[model samples]
Target: MDKEFKLASQLLTLLDTEQRWFTLAEIEKNLGLSDKTIRKMVEEINKQLPSTMTIEVSRGKGIFLQRDGRSRTVSEVISSMFRETIFYRLMNLLFTNVGRFSVEELAGAMFMSTSSLKKLIVQLNNNDLKPYKLRITYSTPMVKGDELNIRYFYWKLYGDAYEFTGWPFTKINFDFINQLITNIENEKKIVYFINSKRRLSFLVAIVLERVTKGKSVKITEGGYPWEKGAFHLPVKALAKVLEESFSIELLKSEIYFMQSLFSLSQYHYYEGSEMTPMKEVELHKDKEEYQMGNRLLTLLAKVYPNIDVKERFTLEIYEFFDKLLIDNAIPEWMTISKSNLTTYVQKECQQIYQEVQTCMQKWHTAYPSVLYNDFHLTKLTLLVRSSLRYKSKKAFLVIGEEFSIRHYIANLIKKEIGDQLIINTSIMKGLTDEMVQQHHIDFVISNFPVALKTVPVVIISTIPSKRDLDNIRKELLL
Candidate 1:
């Protein structure tokens, strides 16, 4: 994604998440964007969005996103924008072409001058393609890199840009791919999640396209030992179906690549339940990836004693490191933009981010070859945050007004921040410092000034406004 589209997508996502009108200052603070840029982005976004959706800006109230019942989601809107970019267009063109083309030919196809096309390739090679050790060759005007990296790059580009929004492979039969996946599921006695199925379909389509073009993967390093596990039969089944349907034969390395993807945690699992058996966990216990996951959990447990080291979380971490250790060319940057995600983690969850960074550093020291980056840190932070037992802060609401007024204020607070706080109500006459200490109140919310040194007090209107609630949130750090 380009800078403008990324910014527009960020703005749209922010608006979608809140689904409420925001002041100009609030938008500026959250997005770290100036007013002028924001206005331009909104204009461009509005032009691209369907008629049923728009970013509505008001002179006094600022801006908010408005969507009708038929409007597409934020992901779909971003995907549509991605399709308009030259990067997506170029990648799609190359995949479909699957062969060498002259710079003039490519430039003409994209309706651009050869000079401009060469400059774009230079930029991509220096930045986006640098991490993958991949680049668009100037002479052939095709993606030139390790076979694994080439396949992985296309998989990620297509997966991130299109996802479930639309199929990018126009020539490939979607039903045929679905049937292939179904046959594998039947043979393996397991079913893929809807998302996993879609992801597998993309991988299959990419493999078919590449294989048909004689672009085969060759495992030069210690190859993936697919036969050691339970995936060989499924791999054979997939190969047979591809050969039967597309009249193309997949090499051993191509089959192993498919096996590696299928075994990833993101792709599939046992049919009946989401849980992985403890016996299976023990089976991989001796593996370095499993041990690494164990060490990470142990280190994190010091900070978060209540962190749930359940089977699912443990399995995911194991599988993550497993992918990292494998020779397959999964990018260290992962799918999302590195800077954007890292910035989010740094701002929103600083402590978790710092701890995960420390853990990553330690892992890098242990295994110097596996390049861990912000993507790994962000993912581990999310996993740790999910496992934590978050305790809600207790709030005592003291109102000097009548029953209805107190009830109304309490209900308003509840509606805004009920999940993060334990709300307790009391009339002013019944409130005391002893009571506040006895209940261990984190903060006090009152209409009148409360003379309590034990806990911080927030003064609000008898009927609280949005500003009043916001103030309460600031005091409580909610």
Candidate 2:
């Protein structure tokens, strides 16, 4: 089951969405296999399926998954997801050590000859490790790179591993970590948004363990400068909890790191020490992260010189790309539910995908030690695609029988996809090519069937259905 898990995930991404009749040719195209090869993957997925969940196939229409009432469970499927052998062992060791162990200690513990360890380090460096900007210096024998990317790399190791029981859950004291999380949440008046909450707890546990080993992260570049401000209150509160639990006050840099966590996950922030949603939660843009973002964009711009990187959303996308490197928002729950969207992005946004692949390859040639997954490449591709359509007109015409109903459908579509799409209203109006081009509308949303010689039109219920929304998302994101 080597690439079997990947096959299951890629296939699931194709069929899971409402445009359910994903063609066999499409599957074969995206996954790079024949019909026979695809069927074998379906069989593998079926073995893991509960009675309520199964992939249903139609010879002419292609495939879709049928869920009988309850949601599909993938504990069987996800549990089997892992890479094999040397890379796995090396990564697991890195996660356990963080900064606690040196190269000599790691090599000795892995029971490998120094030469073998050197070769593996070289191999990893020569591959995807370049993006993390990290390398193994034999002199120090510790992984050294940008601190934020290193932390994200460590988190990704936990993410890529098969065990779903949140590794730190097994390695750390559950009650102690949970209480620390609760103390922060209550004092801050925030919801810890399950997955990220657990990630924060796990991080605290790692810090706690590292502290026990007398390991403390130094205040270096990449951390947001710690300041005594309104946000500092929560950080101070959290630091107090940690001090009580660990019997030591956290260093200034540690408090700065904690401030980042709160800002990123916060639902709202206090303005003038008063809780208000009107004032946006301020996310600190570290000087190093901004430079990293600019450097990456500059590289991509070198490859695609004609594309507009000056757009506000384009800059935002680079920041999004940077955050993906260090963000601790690793989802505790894993599924191929978004595989359809991810695969669609891969296929539809080929230009951006190729540009990113080239950018990564270019970096690899220079750095040679950055590790990344195909999934992240796909995610980054989506970010690039978002910039492609940034603030561009998305919905052209809304056709309906009457004024009230048409306006209502238009509003509903806006409510559902307002963030990703821009809908312009024209009721009882014939959507012509002239109108579409004039408005720069990408697609049409109509309660009635509307035809276009050059553009695509989607017919939907006046109120919009799941099928309607799904198809819209396909057009929007893919």
Candidate 3:
């Protein structure tokens, strides 16, 4: 077989035994196929394979190989789907990174004419699976010859025009822009800060303009860091706009320009700072940290969790912030960070114990005899505390029924300390999920421990029953 065909076959072989889907890029990397070769091979395979089998293309998403004997292959139906061109890939990269795009920026990224992009966008919109839609409109000064900077585009895109236009050229609606901004901001893959600034500036400007019009603005009582400019607009007008548009109540807080500066500095620091922290890691315990010390691990994992963290950290800080503020108290325009977020996370973890202890004490007072017992109270306290600050807090608790007491220890962990711990009792007659619907299990526990850590394995006699062992082994094959 040719190299690309050989690679495709190898990938199919690898996939045949498993019951999980993979993205196109992943398959290409694993099989060592260039984009062109892979697409050609996939097309050939589509014609050759049974009607049930074909390559599934998710435009702007990715590709997957699917086999369903029962259904006429959707891939076949969409087989005539236009092959993704270089521009498609380029546009996907840019648009997927930042939700909205200006003609200039889009042209720059694609290295194409602005007019060409606009034409392409029109064609793209007409496609059956038009994953992205483009909207373009320009606002000239009611006065002529006004210099149009980046802000001009921003204002136009998010200003009153958004509401009027539909399809190819719709007016910019702030609500839609807000939704787009929120979606892009939270996404892990795209971190386009420059575009983000443009988006945010528009939202801030709109909010500011309403307040200045002497309209009724509702400003919250407690101050915020970004409240100075917020006050420039009338409180009555602000409140009305916030309530109507965002359903948020405004709070009185001065903007922390210094903190913003620091955050910006830290962003740069994070980009270039590969320097390891001065901390020794006990490899015998959490061996994954041997390559990089604990200090580096903590920084890398927390700050850039998506790319860096092998383990996922459950952040309930947003929930905490939500509770701290009154309804709609914090606007999207406002951003805040702990003085030192890294240190803050560690300190907050430490404090969970005290917080839990306080709750337990409340339980003690409410039902004295039931909870007052020292053993129960202590166990509850430790469970709560340990759950928060547990070493490898981000990793799973792998429970193999070993005579070494580790299995029993994991059980004790659940019995003593609940909620914060997820005991993946996979070794205990673990009914292997063929297609482990990840949605069913807690992410913190459901991950394969072997992939999560690199600790040595001594497969002791205290292993789970043969059936359970077989099941775990089979699942590992996937």
Candidate 4:
């Protein structure tokens, strides 16, 4: 990732989220950027935005935005804030001056000296472009390696083109673009996520841009079993639209490129529907994704003995693994942070989180080449959360089987909780040792100490006091 974009994005986010004024010291504390750099970034941002959307400063109040209307959405603000950065301006130059352009011409367009332009290209080549084995063939300004990588780079760089709030590709027509997307979606019969539509449109823009540069992408081999049949109609329709729009026929490889991109796990999902939960995963008799999912899970069981979520959340796990296997975007696009998602999973599912770490270690032992990140952990935790949502706990209340008291305490517990807890009242006859073991009782809620060792026991008032119920609530979670 480019440092400039990162700095600008964080600055915009801090201002956007806080809304109220922030002193230079406060902003400096959060971002760790010097006051001079902050002022310069603010200046750069104001230059890109229209006059109506501006940041203002007061004598003692510090800095805040003065928007003409409602606060800008995060995406909208990011797109605009990064628009005139030296990085994107360079991007605009490279993508537009496709066929051939001189170093001087490019530098002039971006208002940069030729030497600075060279240094920037060198920086990009050594950092972001190095991993994909892609380079800016700068002598004549052409792309090297896979055209698909070039497209993905653009997706990460400026994001997809939007009517106003995003990167604007003036050459492409919105109506025509919509028609192509519609053709693909209608024939594929799969619904895209909310972000997919805009992203799909950008890929179309990518194709148009590359074709303008007399380039085409091809993925000749290693195609999945389900890709071709699923991709045919949409691919054909999109090809026709592009050809008609550009007055140029596409090479076969270009068509193959689109098909392969759609096949990537990032593009779509199984149509949203109710899938029945399972007690144990049944290996799919034919589906490859399901089979692969089960195989990984079988290996996972060796790492952690308690591996029920692998099967309990089979459909979710299957789709997740399938997507990760084919996802084409760089994992860098999704930052790995100490987020609420990860923290909640760690706090609520500590045992499972540890097991997942073990499973990941086992995976590395088997295949030492690939690296893992929090993106994988976050998704796994999401599956854990889904699996746990359907998990029902068994609880036995030892409140001395007095008819009135049991009924009253049961009613109170019912009002406090719900079907979440399956409660059975038992008399305080010193408790049965085998009962806890047989029924898989999560915890025993009793008024008197049961002196048990296997299952957790929480002592509570027979009358169900607020403090007692609170203690019971905390125990039930375990």
Candidate structures ordered by TM-score, highest first:
1, 4, 2, 3
lDDT of 3 at 416: 44
> TM-score of each candidate?
0.74, 0.52, 0.22, 0.66
Top of the candidates by lDDT: 1
* Alpha carbon lDDT at 15, candidate 1: 91
After superposing candidate 4 on the true structure, give the runs of residues whose Cα lies further than 4 Å from its correct spot: 1-5, 15-26, 35-69, 160-167, 226-229, 244-252, 265-285, 296-313, 325-354, 360-377, 390-478
Task: List clashing residue pairs in candidate 1.
Answer: none
The CA lDDT of each predicted structure is 0.76, 0.61, 0.37, 0.65
Q: Residue 155 error for model 2, in Å?
A: 2.3
- lDDT (Cα, tens digit) per residue for candidate 4, span 438-465: 7678888888878788878878876777
Residue pairs in collision within model 4:
none
Error of 1 at 1 (Å): 5.6
Summed over model 3, clashes come to 31
Q: For residues 1-478, could you state the per-residue lDDT of candidate 2 as single tens digits?
A: 1346666766775565554667889888888999988877788677777677788777888877776645543443343344334556676667566665667777887788878888878867766576566776664466666554555566555544533454543556777767867776667666666666666665666566555555565553343334633356776776777788668768866665655555454243233546443222123244444545566677866765444566454445544443443332222111111233566666666556777988877655643433455666776677665554333347864654577766777777778666767777754245688878877778887777776877788778767886677567557543
Q: How does model 4 fare in lDDT? A: 0.65
Candidate that would win on TM-score: 1
lDDT of 4 at 108: 77
Q: How large an RMSD does model 1 have?
A: 5.8
Instruction: List ranges where model 3 is wrong by over 4 Å.
Output: 1-198, 208-216, 221-323, 326-478
- Sorted by lDDT (best first), the order is 1, 4, 2, 3
Per-residue alpha-carbon lDDT of model 3 for 1-478, expressed as tens digits? 0233345556555555555666667777788777677667777667756666766656555566678757643333322221223333443343233334566666667687877766655554454122112332322101111111122322433432222222111233556545443443333122335444343535454444333332223334443323332123333343445456654444333123211221222111123333222211110123311322233234323422232222222111111222222212333212221222334333433343344445545534533432122222233333333223322222134444454566575565455444444544444333233212332332223213433222222132333443333222222222
